[model samples]
Target: MADEEVWKAIDDLHAWLDANKAVDGPEALLLRVLKLSEEVGEVAQAVIGATGQNPRKGTSHTWDDVRSELCDVVITALVALRTLTPDAREVFATHLAGVTERSLDGRTP
Candidate 1:
C-alpha cells in the first residue's frame, strides 16, 4: 500500500474511534497511546507461542499470528501518534529518514 493510503486508513480509524469513544480530550489520547503497550504485549505473546517457548502452550501460534500481531502494533502506534498530532505522516517520515540515515549511513547524533 502507498504511504498516502496508510495515513488515510489511520485517519479513518482515528475518526471512527473518536466518534465511538465515551471519553475525549487528553484522556482519550492517553488511552490511545496506552493501547500500543497492549498490542506490543500481544506481539510478544505470539512470538513466544510461535517459538514454543511456553511449555504449557507448545506452539499454539504460527508465524503468521506473530506477523498479524506486529501489524497491530504498528497500527496502534500510528493511531496513537495521530491522536497526538495531525501531522503524523510528516512526523513519521522525518523520523524514519533520520533513523535510516543513522543506521545505514553510520551517522551519529
Candidate 2:
C-alpha cells in the first residue's frame, strides 16, 4: 500500500507534467538544474538573511525563497536521469524496491 501510493503519486505528477509539458528531457533537465541551483542559492540567502548576515553585495534570501530551489533540484535530477535512461521509471522502481527490502531486513542495499 505504501509503495502503491508512491507510484501513484509519481504517476499523478507525470500526468500533470504531460499536461503541462513541463518535464521534457535534456533541455528540460538543464533548465530544471539551473532553476534548482538558483533556488538552493536562495535558500542559502535565506539562511544568511535569517542570521542577519549580509552576504557580500546582492546576495541574500529567506527560507521560503530557497525551498523552491531545492524542489527544483529534485525535479531536474529526475528529468535528467529520465533523459538518459529512457526507462527511468523502471530504474527508480527497481532501486526503491531494493532499498525497501534492504531496509526491511535491516541492512544496507
lDDT string for model 2 (34-99, tens) is 655666666676667656677464445556655766665565556545544657678987888888
Off by over 4 Å in 1: 106-109
Q: List the residue pairs that clash in candidate 2.
A: 39-69, 43-66, 45-61, 46-61, 46-62
lDDT of each: 0.92, 0.62
State the weakest 10-residue window (summed lDDT) of model 2.
Answer: 75-84
Candidate 2, residue 104: the lDDT equals 84
**Candidate 1 residue pairs in backbone clash:** none
What is the clash count of model 1? 0
Could you say which candidate leads in lDDT?
1
lDDT of 2 at 46: 67
Q: Which stretches of candidate 2 lie over 4 Å from their true place?
A: 1-46, 49-51, 55-59, 100-109
